[model samples]
Target: MGKKGILLVNLGTPDSPEVSDVRRYLDEFLMDERVIDINAFQRTLLVKGIIVPFRSPKTSKLYKEIWDENGSPLLYFSKIQAAMVQEKLGDEYQVELAMRYQNPSIASGLDRLKAGLVESIQVIPLFPQYASASTGSVIQKVMELVGKWQTVPPISFINSFHDNELMIDTFAENAQKYQPESYDQILFSFHGLPERQLKKCDHTGQHCLKKDDCCSTLTDVNKFCYSAQCHDTARLIAKKLNIPAEKYSVCFQSRLGKEPWVQPYTSDVLKALAEKGKKRLLVFCPAFVADCLETLYEVSVEYHEEFRALGGEEVQLVASLNDDPKFIDALVAMVKN
Candidate 1:
């Protein structure tokens, strides 16, 4: 076999934090049938007419707040990750990075691998959990692009590493940097998905959102369930941190539209904690590997203010595993294996 190839893909960032750039990014991202889970006409109407026009400017401002001097924290760290993985793997394997939506697109990354005429390619979507909107989208996009290739190589996907020991350890390690015990509560917040999306994946038809504890444990039926995987990720990280189940709570953030999303919502959790006089909270967003607008601005800044107004002392966000050496090691092992 010829040299193997590794492609590390993450959810994209806007070319710039400008409203125009953000609008374009939103159009591409929110318009995806996998993302909005609606017909093109409806999705386009909702995204273009309602979401992009109103949300872009506001979101662009938030993006600017978190935008590092180098660039987007997500893209910057991803570049570092790809470079480090390449160095670790040495000349035996070629490593490339792509953002699923924007700059350094999957098409460009795949083209590079095709130029090398690699024997096989391992495409690792950076999402820890397998959401159709995230990991599934990346896989679908890669297949669509690679399908047209005259000499398509063998390809494999690392779909989900939510419970990978090293990954869990890295998140635990990041949390340990701060005083985990100093906070009143440790909130494990994952990105929210619509309830309908979760049910769509329920092959058992009665598993998702049916029982309260259905997502508490990972079963073969809910193995690919995003909510279940998020809970599992939280459980593993909390276990590593020696956090008692009662002391910490699992919640979801970034709910869109009026339709119910996977609950308990992070905002609701914060409000409840504040009402109960649980101040000085710590939050962990395990769904995201790198600090982006959601983590840096939304959780760190926006949520902080929300909790403060509700009579909480502080809502400290744990830094994500952005270009961390341990995280790169975990990625290296995942790819090389």
Candidate 2:
């Protein structure tokens, strides 16, 4: 009988929250063509000369705020999710965990699968939504590595599972657990990508929505469009909770560089709400299945403080969908398909 296996991959974290470790992680992360999407020489200068040198110290400080005794929340939570999925899937399909960058690299994970003599491999990139930078990068990396092998197992990829029922249910469950006293506003913040990237989807500007009705409407392309899907997630969750559409907003966060990224920027939205005298806020980051730098430090701490500074009375960040049993069931179902 042919061996079947599953490999889970996530955007990784630093080995430690220290400045040095964070710098190393950033170097690997930002250097990626998908992440930076620039020429090699230019990417190097930006990553090493600029980002690693400057951003690392600041990011290291931020990581310290969220880092636990175990380590980076992203890495720790990912491990938990992987183990839970493994347990649920049983022993028949060996499961291995990997990160796109840093330790437990994709190369290493594939090596383990090869050593196990698995006949078929299933790759699950942990990003719930598809983006050229996230899910696309993983597929690119897998193909590059497997292409080098003289003999390779048949591979299948679970691309975007954003609207999976179990996933949506898990998110709803977490939001319910928080039980906000009565939020005047709910914000769904997703990581930002450059507008140039979004335009790349349809350069003619005919197929692209540019954050208009086309994106808001249910369509085949919008089904996989990260920005549209984020809005859809907010709508679904709001429908489940019976929240009014006027009470919620969908925004983007973690924007890098000066390039225009998909917006209603999260920071700008926070400031606007505060200015409008909307004090109570509940923010949810459904883009990230696990709490990472973006959700943990960037949204929970940084954005929370921003809201308060803008005279907001309260800002609560809903937790991520990490190792929640329903979410694990979603993963199993996703792979089973």
Candidate 3:
């Protein structure tokens, strides 16, 4: 008889918010085929020759904005999360924290667990939704590393917890703190993926965007679709908060060099709302479990500025589930069962 091993993985951060470190981080992150979904040579040219060279300094500055005296918010909170889960789980399990793309790599996390010689291992990729780029990449990387082991322990992975009740409640509870009714509209904005990625996830060839309201509800045809899961997550949170369907919009953000990404883009949605004379806005970024660059800098600063310039009064972000006791409790439940 033996204890279970738990490994938690999140999308990574740069070693530091310096230009060189940011460049290295971006190169590693964007070069993933799952991420950019382009031919290797073209990805290299786009990432190395263009993005890394041009965007590194700009991105470093964004990281700097979110970075604090304690360092990267994502990593900082991730550390607290792992420690808390470990403490609550007691000596029955050993918990390890990892990042999909950077320091405290998945390899190290798995190795540490294997050293613990537990009877089984459970891997929880921190992304709430399942996407080829994020959760899928982590699964593939974990398998690729552990597949080499001579004696592999029985292992399981949590693919997605988008509709996890406790998790959704946590997000809704966070939004309630800001008085959701005070805002003119609520936006549930998720990180964007290229339309091609959505198509690839569509098991039925004709299901994706081929019919009206394709992503309006989740079904077998699009159950694994990232956009659908994102929509489902938003719907659950909104329903929990008693928000009417018309009062909120499900949108996507952080698109880059896009041919097209799952739309309506958050930026475009804000413009539409502004044109309609909707001033105050409340935004929930449920995609990210911890408050990082995307939630803290992009949503809070960049989007707010853009919206205000468009004549919107305010764009307030609902804080993420960062080491919140309730969030950690939800995580502990997922780990246990």
The clash count of every prediction, one per candidate, is: 0, 0, 0
How does residue 293 of candidate 2 score in lDDT?
83
Q: After superposition, how far is residue 319 of candidate 1 from its true place, in Å?
A: 0.7
**Model 1, CA-based lDDT:** 0.92
What pairs collide in candidate 1?
none
Which parts of model 2 are misplaced by more than 4 Å?
209-211
TM-score of each predicted structure versus truth? 0.98, 0.96, 0.98
lDDT of 1 by residue, 80-119 (tens): 9999999989988989999999889999999998888788
Tell me the RMSD of model 3 versus the true structure. 0.9
Q: Write the per-residue lDDT of candidate 3 for residues 1-337, one digit (tens) a residue.
A: 7889999999999999999999988999999989999899999899999999999999998898888998999999999999999999999998999999889999999989888888898999999999999999999998999899998899899999999998999999999889999899999999999999999997778899896589889998888889999999999999999999999999999999849889999999999999999999999999999999999989999999999999999999999999888889988999888
lDDT of residue 223 for candidate 2: 61
- Estimate every model's Cα lDDT from 0 to 1: 0.92, 0.85, 0.93
Provide the global lDDT of candidate 2 against the true structure: 0.85
Model 2: lDDT of residue 34: 86
Ranked by lDDT, top first? 3, 1, 2
Higher-scoring candidate on lDDT, 2 or 3: 3
